[model samples]
Target: MSSSWYRDDTAPPPPLAGEGWGEGVSTSDNPQEERTLSRIASDDAMRPPPQAGEVKTARGQMSRVLRAPLLLALALAATPAHAFIAYVSNEKSNTVSVIDTDSWTVTKTIKVGQRPRGIEFTRDGKFVMVAVGDDDTIQVIDVKTQAVMDSLPSGPDPELFAQDAAGKTLYVANENDNTVTVIDLEKRARLGDIQVGVEPEGMTISPDGKTLINTSETTNMAHFIDTTSRQIVANVLVDARPRFAEFKHDSSELWVSSEIGGTVSVIDPRKHEVIGKVTFEIPGLRKEAIQPVGIGMTRDDKTAFVALGPANRIAVVDVATRKVTKYLLVGQRVWHMAFTPDEKYLLTTNGVSNDVSVIDVAAQKVIKTIQVGELPWGITIAP
Candidate 1:
């Protein structure tokens, strides 16, 4: 009877001999098979067995290394939690007041060009641009440094400007020249000028960035300018002395406040026609008392707050119903206002009182008054 026999050797075996299995089965398979089998033959010789404590530590270290990048990625994604700052254009002082929304205090007083009226931050939040009407240019301030960086070329007496969503262009309204100066923000140069009616005050760009609306104070008309060609497309008649113009948050409607006409004209931007008019008539106050000036609307387009200059109050209107819900008593000659990002506070600049009235939006009451530079006209908060 034939029987299989086994022999164990302590020495290392030879290298593999052939690719095929049967070609060299007996002699070639032994050394090759011994080498492969020797790896696990002895528990002490297999490898230096890791200490029990070291094995657990190595596993924890490997796990952390594998998760390190994912943890770092999550930390990076959570960065850039910045607080918003509001810039108020002090017309008489020729300075810009930087207000910290978190503390509700003026963080800095930045001296700008002459007669800074309309102020806005770039869409990227890198720069704050202020329209200095008397200087006839737009002063740019770096947000990180809070310093004057440069000036954009504007037409004569640029009162206000509207920036495109890309922040690549600026449409400046020239009050003295009665024209809109188109500017290339990147190039920092004036592209061209589109002539409009008398004393254009408030300017706004359509949601699609295809059209621009320039509200003329004396002409009482909103001139729609084609953005691509930079030409006047149409003119919609509005109330007299239109001071402040705001597009609804949803970009569905446009509201133009007439200081002298004592009304707010809501217009359909597409058709360039007055779709509705909001007029105020308080019991003891005269029809002229409720002179709407600054307009602030919620991001949801649910509520609109209109500043009644001489009335010393803000008329809260429901956007859906287009009706005045309540009149909030504020400071004297409330010229303009800006809403906090959270929609909790509405700050109104009272021209005559020389202060900013902070109104609680939820309660509809003036909670505090902050003294600012003389004659604060236009205000805007940084994103």
Candidate 2:
């Protein structure tokens, strides 16, 4: 196990859980209250914006050419600052690399706790959260400032987590203890914990925020926990070593990726059963190389992208038919992926090759390969 795609292979797995995404801590009591959007944001949000109707008047039109530059100057002066960013967690390096998506370069390197894997941004897009399993905490980073500001309490070996739609609570999957840790985002308090299968790893909340799903790696099952009751309502058996979970925009189906199963399991959210399975086959590639781990789908649910661990390729699946339509070759051991808010591009973390592959969503092809930190495990993009 000297070079396994997953960590914790030296010893017997502590049980399974899915805590993907990256970042390291915020301790401020008012963390949420301090979030600010990127510029194009006004110098002062309270200031009134220029009315477009005023520009339609005859007198306004006469002066429009002269006022155009002045208006642009004012707007530029009012710009506070923000950018589309991608956060990548390097397991071996124990740090998070912040990439400016526009520039496609590493802008900052953040020192985090040991074993930072799963990461995501808050609902408000103000802060990025990274699960530090060794520290038993989730660190928060300020988006505008690009600094580690605070942290929230997490369960043992917190590898993956999910937050409510309202951004009120966070549900964490604790790998070592076979439980899901719950935290109040506002209060930064430990709300509770939910018992799940052995070695629970994958975690994701539904689109409507009614159901929270956690997949246990060893149990080979996805456990659906109701957000309100904090109890497991249904358990659907999946393929082996389920590592990640994603839901479609309409919340009709939940996609679960089994790293060792070589297939993507589609579960019906309402009935809580395996409705379909997506399998991939590369002509010259062996079956074991096509182990699926991360999943990303278009907003319209027309296409789905699954990251094949050792295959060095991403399988594009037709969402409607659950069929493999294409395979785009990428860097070695591609793991997690995230799309730009506009859905123009998708970024995948190539772990073994120590870089990231940028794919053009419209063309369904990799456009660029960016050099990142060592063993870039999980990645997420911020608006």
Candidate 3:
């Protein structure tokens, strides 16, 4: 709502009110309960799908006009145009907000493990896995029913994670420990841990899935681990407090965002050398305030968007020229962003304002802001 909600970039986040997982929050083991939950999605098929360009205020009354079940079922069977579900992890609220892109509204808030962050859909799209840092594990949610069904053993304080190209292996960045935990996705077992630098926060794998990249906040280095050996092959030093790392689609460049350094290091993936840097400049904001945390690139690699944490802006960078083309004013403390499958729109999580900003990618304009849970950290859209 106001600028006062934004927290200081340099300071630690506000202390969480609750510590352990909430009561009755563990995975359900009852077969009946599981079956009942699965039927929820099926029963929802009787309701009519929201039409495109429909106003949000009128969405609630659509259920009242539901006609014959056959007609509604037919509507549900026919997929809506470019419909996708976006999941946002609210770090402080211990919940995941599910937004139906068709209506651009939050359809459900699913209760999850404590401090849920770093969420993504599995390759098969059957389930959504979210790293619950406080629980010392990753929780899995069934996509159809939107319920927490199981959990994976992650190391202590798993803040971020990256899956292999096949989605068979998962590499988790455990913030509390100086190691990345490797897990077998199919078997749902912990393979082992690869020691990295201190306070590892960013996790990403290359396009070929051979190299795993992890950035340590305290160590100020990007550790390149050979996925085959599960060992650190090389470490490239970056600026202060590197928070996030992203690779171009063609695997030519790797961009690492340094939070305190206020710059992004563009590294050559093949040579593992810093070839260039993407810097951001805001007219009235101090350098410290323009901390870059999350980065998103286009499929063609022609453009990139960097989230300026406290500056409350998204810097649009021209990839070839390496220049800031525009700065978009979004909600306060924009943390991360994800694009829809079609790339027609981009949604950003604004922590302080407790909402997600929808940006029309082609127009480069802020179109709408949808309210979500508190301290929204990360987001992932369905493929």
Candidate 4:
């Protein structure tokens, strides 16, 4: 096994129970209360004015009435605005952990084919598709029932995949065959295959849905393909063992993570060139342990978050400067990450620790750790 794979190949412990399902912790005992008083005009049409002796009692009742709605508004604001479901793929245990974002707990453990990885929610949010490499197929999980319902025809040993903006077409990187298989999502049938480099691992599509990218680990290159012809248009060499690729929302830049090189390559999509690189450094840790595998960027393209595989930290990066702003310590062997629909919280899967770390985006702080399945590899949150 390659030195990088050795770290992930070690026997993982049994899947841990999803615990710590407690109420949201409050930082302060009392929240800031706001009082909004309604105009109380004296009107003979409704009722006569209060007597002088009862004025004080009437004022007290009015105070209580105004405070009630303010308190109710505060309670509603403190609750989570949205409840998003997150699916985590467990590589070793052959299962998926379904987490409810509102409660911050795993509601279900879904048993699936062997070696599940590269999970994503469909555009319609009705189903979740997961690549089970060992089983040589992609399985579909029904969102409502929380069960495996069907399978897709993927190339041999499908690893990572990407779908078009419309979610009608799927491109899967088949590691064993050195090819990318195209599947018709609506029909649930295989369309064709596009040849790529050896051991293709990472997959992504552009925002306009005109181009597709597949990164090869063994070949150490990113192959850009045109969606119209399903042919490679350009090849750009990157650092060693590129494992994941991500594109900006505007399609201006592409980011590829090299696991063994311990760096993230920033590429210009228009020029198809490496424009910059984002590196990570943690005190007292060797460079070899800081292997970056997954990346997540904000919708506005201002900030980015990268998962350093064995370093047990998530590097926060400034997109404009291409510099690491801070490294937040997390669980062991962090693999992948996903953001909630509103981008308030970012969840990361930790393989060795068998848990996921929840980060409050605006605060840049690790807020919660949720225990999940064994060797959690990939994660996807509902839109």
Candidate 5:
């Protein structure tokens, strides 16, 4: 008879039962017992000991992974569905164009006073106010109805205005009078006027809403006015034909762009001195074409975009270094630009082209252009 090695139910049989066919055979163990023992040993090795702490940790990690998607879904649901609206003032047409930001389409055309140059929205986003230079008044429009609601008592040839953060006060720049008319938005009446330089065009308020800056065109100076006292605090001389003024996000510096001078002056608001100047020189571009008109700075104060009117382009400037990085081609006679609420898009009014160019800020390119009335100039985004 032949003998073979086998395992028992509890454990492996001590050793092979047979050697040299029969002489060392163990008669006590059977094949069935050896097989059962082998099976038991295999089960012991495969079974894992339960660990309570490790199981709890694993459960927590899985729950966190599952929550990430749910949180993302909630955030997406909370985001606004509708895009912001932009108001564009058409100089020749004496009309305003309402743009739906989501579709980049013009939704309505509202008639306003003659020579509407500067346009802005109330901080509360309830009304759209426009400065009609020829009409010498500020026309207020109801955003929902797309109709003229009322008019504010602005000084002669009201060109531009700036609103405080609280949306309570508005400072209007009268080009002909060379004065800024202060108005209370709540009352819809003019409070008083502060004398500025010749041809006050661009107006802006500091972040704190304590100081107001007005740029004079022919006088070539930025006049700083204290909002509370309504007095001219500082007058910083700049280049020829200073058109637009913008304050840095932190209100640490002020940027004034000169149209005829083709340069930008960076001024220290506290010291009222020119800290640096930004200039551009591109081959084949005529010096006269690079007339800077509107100025805009990013929220972080890292970048600045200057509109070149005759050049039909925008110059991107590095705020920290005060250097012109690149020039982006835009519509014809690009005048002013208003950034969207999300700061993803920049819509610029093309005066000569009779259209508005939508620029993708991240891509730094014009993605779409929508035709507007003749001589589209001032632009503002509704709150």
Candidate 6:
């Protein structure tokens, strides 16, 4: 595909007319479908589980994939208070594109530091934080102006970061320094740094605000840090190349995706132990290509989505049983993802394909693909 295919614009060229990139047109909405969705939402299991102690559940999950997108509009209507604007970091393009979910279009693009990767919106939704690895600093973007307002003093080669519940403290993973840099978000100054295993890449804080977690890529372990003391209280070793760590909303489990290991290590947050490991299998793809990177789970924690990087698919895992449910084919080299505020939609960054794939949360299908900058990576939505 030509470089022109990746652009920050209102829309890409006509789908059929364009060269090779593919995107789905929005499906027509039916007003009467609201009642039907309500009944589906109320069901104990919208689709029946295969059987008790079933080792494989792909057949049942594949059947539900097509019908999931149809239910999201109704889910959004049920809770109308939360609407979000999504921001995506473009590593090669050195820019961040603002996406308007209502229209599913790129509304604006702001220039930023080179090699921008990890990005997130502040707790108050007033700002966006982007880690520019090459620049060795994290830039702050004002949500109202959509421009770079300031930069935080992150340690060398800062790749990812996590903030506290009150949004007052920031824990940054400095890949080059082998340490997690702590900063005071309010003061915009460095507080201190905690030395950790080499190549620290992922950072996430617990939902209850009691713990902060960092995953070192080379160490293959998730280091649990106590928020108050800023110490590595426990280290739970996981698969190789643990790139991203996420805490379940309920605080019961922490999921880490290992790109090279081709598995997701499911850890019990309370015990700092690996309870189970989730693996993926795609019929035609080689085992080496099944590199899992990003993860997203529903508020109920019933459904978990893992992005299989080079496999070009997202594996749906059953939360209760810790088994692979199904794999939904997406664009190339899928990297990171974020859910709409209402949890009705999930948008994932496809790096090699140079676009963002949208998944309808309820239907569990890739409903749409939006054109973004080259190597679209990190994504976060306003609260």
TM-score of each: 0.77, 0.79, 0.80, 0.82, 0.79, 0.79
Model 5: CA > 4 A from native: 1-81
**Residue 65 lDDT in candidate 5:** 58
lDDT (tens digit, per residue) of candidate 4 on 249-360 = 9899999999999999999988999999998889899999999999999999999999999999999999999999999999999999999989999999999999999999
Model 3 spans > 4 angstroms off: 1-80
Q: Please rank every candidate by lDDT, starting with the best.
A: 4, 3, 6, 5, 2, 1
For model 1 the local lDDT of residue 215 reads 91
- Candidate 1: stretches off by over 4 Å: 1-82
Q: lDDT by residue for model 3 over 70-171, one digit each (tens)?
A: 453555556456579999999999999999988999999999999998998887677789999999999988888899978889899999999987878889
lDDT of 2 by residue, 1-383 (tens): 12211112255443234311112232222322222222222344464666876445677556644554465566556654345789998877888899987678899999888888989988777788999888889988777777777888988989988888787789999999999999988778898889999998899888888899999999999998988898899999999999999999999999999999988999999998898999989998888878999999999999999999889999999999999999999999999899988888899999999999999999998999998888888888875
Q: What C-alpha lDDT do the candidate models reach, one value each?
A: 0.81, 0.84, 0.88, 0.89, 0.85, 0.86
lDDT of 6 at 276: 91
lDDT of 2 at 140: 85
For this target, which candidate reaches the highest lDDT against the unseen true structure?
4
Question: lDDT tens digits, residues 1-383, model 6?
Answer: 22221122455565354322223332234333444544555563565665787766677566566555557565566654434799999999999999988778999999999899999887777789999999999998888889997888999999999988777888999999899999888777899999999999988999999898999999998999998999989999999999998888899999999999999999999988999999888888899999999999889988889989989998889988989888888999999999997889999999999899999988988999899898999999988
Question: Once superposed on the true structure, which residue ranges of model 2 sit more than 4 Å away at CA?
Answer: 1-83
Residue pairs in candidate 4 whose N, alpha carbon or C atoms collide under 3 angstroms: none
Worst 10 residues of 1 by lDDT: 1-10
- Tens digits of per-residue lDDT for model 5 on 322-369? 998888888999999999988888889999999998888888888999
Pairs that collide in candidate 3 are none
> Distance from true position, residue 14, model 3, in Å?
55
Residue pairs in candidate 1 whose N, alpha carbon or C atoms collide under 3 angstroms: none
